[model samples]
Target: MKRFFLQILLCLAALMVLGGCQSKSEIVKLPRPVGTLAVAGFTNPMFNWELLAGYLPHEGQPVNKRVIRELDQKLVQTLGKHGVTAYARPAITRQCQEIEVFENMGSKREAAFSYWISVGECMAADYLLVPQVLFWQPHRGMKKPNYNVQPASVVIDLYLIDVNNKRIVRRIHFDETQQPLSENMLEAGKFFERGGKWVSAMELAEEALDNGLMELGL
Candidate 1:
């Protein structure tokens, strides 16, 4: 009967939908390196405010130095749990100054690369781990869920450099901006995982840190 066929089609569609919902993307693991790693800590991007007027508000706020220090320590501790020896060097003002000199002469990327190499030599670390905070927008209201409030957003990049080889061992980039389930259906699982509550910038960054490290197999 036509009605029976319609019901069967609907059931098949429902099953297909459920299957899609349960599917998850696989995370590719990189080779784990041997030897100790020194965490270089987080750094803020240097942007020209005049040229990036519209983007200033989103990324202009200075991340607290204390927060940076805490993240560095957290990374070191996380590595320790994985049986990886690591140390944190949160104070990098002098290193930044040296990098600036290179920046004045050439591209910022090149300057950073050169600085990192020098840092590895100075620390005598077999490897160096650098974490950079690209953008951070904290929740406006109380660190709890408020339908009327904006959710936190953050972007972080982690790099593991093989000091002796002068090459990158692994890199992970995390960029997350919390949005309502209605806005991004793909993140429905994450929404429910967070209990449908908005989180703070710190919370988001911490999640990113953990996920990044895990993806690195650390």
Candidate 2:
């Protein structure tokens, strides 16, 4: 009888573990936005980007440009794939550049929201998708004889705003952080040494968008 009880307890514990795993893997669905969606691509906001460059290698210019182009393409494709009826509007894109050049939000969150709302209104879009590159930096990894390791880090922020309501419907953020490894010497070094291949900002942006879309259940 005692042995039988032990076996039953073990089975119960296994079931509990499986149940916990399933709960953790449950998919989270994002509320689908209503009406037309316009995507606005980014241009390097001089202040933020310039400051970020101080920490990364190669001045970070190449990555910045690539990120802008890739993000625009990826966002439209991703949103369309998920049945969001999204398009990148040149008018709004141009306006975003103008705002970055002339206006400085300087940590005022509402000011940024108001700008997006106005853009959506001007474009006649019901929702505006705003994506920003928070950071892109390539660290150095052994490169003297033959490049053995290369790694990079990137951060992206995505926002979906309702033009009619002047409200943000979805806000998503992503980070490309290096993970630690124990077995492989190269990967382990890449994680700690802050060194790796110079990854383009565009590539990082594309990854961030892809991740965000997946998280959105798209």
Taken over the whole model, the C-alpha lDDT of each candidate is 0.65, 0.56
Clashing pairs in 2: 63-201, 66-202, 67-202, 139-195, 140-195, 141-195, 150-196, 150-197, 151-196, 151-197
Model 2, residue 155: displacement in angstroms?
Answer: 0.5
Q: In candidate 2, what are the lDDT values of residues 3-105, reduced to their tens digit?
A: 8997577545544444333221354556566677777775443334332122222333444465566666677776676676545564456665455432365
Q: Any runs in candidate 1 off by more than 4 Å, and if so which? A: 1-25, 48-60, 86-106, 142-146
lDDT per residue, candidate 1, 157-180, as tens digits?
A: 787778898877777877888986
Best by TM-score: 1
Q: Candidate 1: lDDT over CA atoms?
A: 0.65
Superposition error at 123 for model 2 (Å): 1.0
Q: For candidate 2, what is the lDDT? A: 0.56
Best candidate (score: lDDT): 1
